[model samples]
Target: MDKLGIYAVPAIIAAIVVFGAVKRIDLFEAFREGAKEGISSLISIAPSLIGLVIAVNMLSASGFFDIAAALLSPVCNAIGFPAELLPLGLIRPVSGSGSFAVLSSVLEKYGPDSIIGKTASVMAGSTETTFYAVAVYYGSVGIRKTRWTIPCALAADLTGMLFAVWTVRLFS
Candidate 1:
């Protein structure tokens, strides 16, 4: 499996080159153009990525997550969800680093073997950083208006968080 993984990309690229040759296309030129396009896309998306990082840092520093967690605590407790895991779930969709920071704190406080910690691990594992991904991908592609992307991704994240807790509790 490890050896196959190591050869996967080169195999895929070789297949592409062969296919392009059969199509009478300039494979090297196409590859070079793709590299250039990728770089430009990276350049275009860099600001959004940097801003996301900064915004996450600011939010983390401002204690806003703690306030949100506190406000949501009662509801979470009633639902049998740990209030401590609230911040990680809420932040996961917006910023991976921010959510991971929350997860790290939870692990530190609760220990990694604790129920909350296992749930956090599963939540982080199962969910995507929706807003961050959309911001970078859309911005790079010059998309100004997004339709249903945020809502759908957040819905998935919420569902993932619930399942993470449910599955963990099922085993425990």
Candidate 2:
């Protein structure tokens, strides 16, 4: 079953080619046209993506996240959350790559087997990069009004982070 799963994608591709042949479709030309469209789409989204990445990087570099993390520590401790996970909680919603960098730093500082490391790993997996998603997806589609997307997504991320900490303690 596991080996069959690995072959599924190839099987699907072969089926698509066979189906196209039976339909007398020019698969190669269609594929080329699709590739060109994809390239054009990339060109459209590139600027927004670059700007989003730059903003995330600026937030990480400004030492502002650290200050915010410090201010949240007392409340975190009261809830049994590890202070070290603060950066991950804050950064996870805005940028996946940024949150990943924070996760890597946490895992390195506290060995991967540590509670903090496990919590960070879980949190990373369970959260989405909300701001980046909105920027790329909405910008690509030309949606101007976000309409409660940011707040809802950030709230979900906060919920995930809290559960991750609690889950780590339950198991460890």
Candidate 3:
């Protein structure tokens, strides 16, 4: 299985090349065009990606996440959610690495078998990096008006987080 994984990508690439040849497609030209498109897409999304990274870093450095987590503790506890996982839920949508740090903290403190650790692991696995996806995909396409995207994505993230907790509680 491990060896198969190593060959899988090369096999896929070889298949694509054969398919393109069968279709009489100019592979080198096609590859060049795709590379150019990718670079352009990267250039288009760069500003939004940079801004998001800076904002996430600023929030982390300013202790906004810590403050928000502290403030949200009461609401979380009221709903039977573990307050320790609040920061993970908050950061998961904006930054994967940031949420990962919070998840690591939870695992270290609570142990993986603990309810909090299970919830954190589930939340991390289930939730999307909402802001990053929106910025990258929308920006790459030059879509400036994301009217319903933010609210809808956030609601989905919240649903995933809540379900993560409930699922852990229900199953464990």
Clashes of each: 0, 0, 0
Tell me which residue pairs clash in candidate 1.
Answer: none
Report the lDDT tens digits of candidate 1 across residue range 1-172.
3366469989998898889999998888998999999999878766766666566557667887678779989999898887878878777897666676667667876899898898999999888888878999999989989999888888888889999999888876
TM-score of each: 0.60, 0.59, 0.60
Q: What is the lDDT of candidate 3?
A: 0.82
- lDDT of residue 125 for candidate 2: 92
Please give, for residues 43-106, the per-residue lDDT of candidate 2 as tens digits. Answer: 8766765666566557657876578768888997898888778877877887666676677667
Off-target runs (Cα >4 Å) in candidate 3 are 1-72
- List the lowest-lDDT window of 10 residues for candidate 1: 48-57
* Residue 138 of model 1, lDDT score: 97
Clashing pairs in 3: none
